[model samples]
Target: MTTPPSPPNPKAIIFDLLTGLLDSWTLWDASTPTGTSLEGRKWRKQYLEVTFGSTVYGPGSTYEELVARSAGESGLPNSAPEALLQNWKDLTAWPEVGRVLRALREKGYLLGVVTNCSKKLGHAAVRNAEKAAEGAGEGTWKFDAAVTAEETGWYKPAVQAYHGILPLLGEGVRPEDVLFVAGSAGDVVGATKAGFRVVWNNHVGLERKGDVLPLREGKSLDEALRDFL
Candidate 1:
């Protein structure tokens, strides 16, 4: 009889910041003038398309600028992007985020973040994530390291962007040994192509577009990471 594949044993767990760990979608939606869910999703979808389509990070335009561009494309007023930026600190974690992260930390798995944003926003967002955990009485949730597209000069799925996190995770952590928790369908393909095993926290029920699949997928963080935890 043929042997079944062994389960993944990851040394480190890397996450996609925006949607994976945080309820950034609500904040993004509220940023619009109308503050309607539909408008917010429209803007966010445009933003994702623009950034992911770029492949390489564009130094010419700041991350904030892209937000404004997405607003315009989504038929939102120019004021929409500014509101989003100003309200960034209000981003909260998903219901299962705080608990799951602490569990992983207790298990001694190295934790990190890899996101597509500027260095300033990237770090600040994670700090906000910590505050959300604190509010939930989950204690201080900290990551060992974080990598941003601005730092790598490449957007995710570019391989380089995902690969950039390895050195920061310390020696002996390799792509195959790391488990990437993806927030979006694109990241599933991106992390896998970068050689990391992936688990998708597909909160919004987004469709998977690429050939490569995550080892597991669920609508909640805890559900997706059930086996790993």
Candidate 2:
């Protein structure tokens, strides 16, 4: 048996589609009224300060620490910290994500979504993606595969989470043949570690932390795909 030649075009463009928790998650909106514009980043900054006591500062912090900090401040018992995690369904897609994803799919590339969301929310995000695609003038944006944290038992920055997608691919896909797009530095590090070409979706123009090294950076998914092409 011989391995197939790597696809001249990528076999898949794997996306770490963060759940609408920042934009749509009702719990977050209720907790803070800053609106989704920069509200998510603001909450996360406060969350880090409140939870980490000045130690860890960003989303790049270890998931265990994040959960621990959030649970502590959330007034939830550490024994069952699940409830402290933010609800994701309240998030709405960014204005252009739907249209861009649909267009990418129409261009004949395989599309996959990987997220650190619970299964229920993950499914909702996919539906949101499909709807967004439709609004963008594409009828539907169906993914070839979708992996949620509930299925992977890990989160971004964990090599296991990235590796979890490998076996889900169809016959010819290789890790190197997939391009991952993520908005967070930790996610970029994890994806790069897992051997995927990574594109940082730096929509806000945040500076990269020292540890993360992405293959490319773009201000939007459209720009990211353009560079990929």
Candidate 3:
């Protein structure tokens, strides 16, 4: 298929944190009892179901609690989530992410992250990305906005979650003016419904879940976003 052109003069670029910028699957896999990607994927799939299917996220809600619940639903032993949390700092960025983000920054695009986790885990993931970028010699890049589901009190695909990023991106930035880099299938529909053009980094090659399509789709961050950079 022919690639779609980048949006004309987007005011900002928002990203989904875990799958968009980071190789979070490996971490999830390593935390599983079998330490196999197959097992990890099974658990991760269940986790996605629980997370995306939820309707609300309040002060009492948390990413950790959801992880544990997913593990149980996956029939994974209790040790899986315990290990996952214990090694949260091990979250790593996709190899090309640092370079891709650096290029976008160089082009004067405003960058941000809107992730489906609590504020604490969301910020920690950003720190991990920074460290990974530094190691890649991309220096340090700052996000104009880093929003989380907990902060929004709603999950992705929810209009509120997508809308929440707008105010944080400062006054006058509208959803249609933003380019959202989606990490998962659900995000394409979510971001589109909220009025942002999307570019999906479909690293795992999951099936498309909705009628909406991203402006671009690729197997890596760089490939998915190179046109814009």
Per-residue lDDT, model 3, residue 21, is 91
Native-referenced Cα lDDT, model 2: 0.60
Candidate 1, residues 3-116, lDDT tens digits: the string is 113356789999999999888899988988888788999899889888787777765556777888889999999889999989988888888777777778889999899999
lDDT of 3: 0.85
Between candidates 2 and 3, which one is better according to TM-score? 3
Model 3 stretches with alpha carbons more than 4 Å out: 1-6
Report lDDT per candidate. Answer: 0.84, 0.60, 0.85
| Top-down lDDT ranking | 3, 1, 2
Residue-level lDDT tens digits of model 3 in 1-229: 3333457879899999999999899999999989998899999988888888884786444778889999999989899999998898899998898777777877888889988898888899988876765666644657778889898999887989888989887888998789999998888888888888899999888778856778888999878887787
Cα displacement (Å) at residue 154, model 3: 0.9
Alpha-carbon RMSD to native, per candidate: 2.8, 7.4, 2.3
Candidate number with the higher lDDT (2 or 3): 3
Error of 2 at 89 (Å): 3.4
Full-model lDDT, candidate 1? 0.84
Please list the residue runs of candidate 2 whose C-alpha ends up more than 4 Å from where it truly belongs after superposition: 1-8, 19-30, 33-42, 45-88
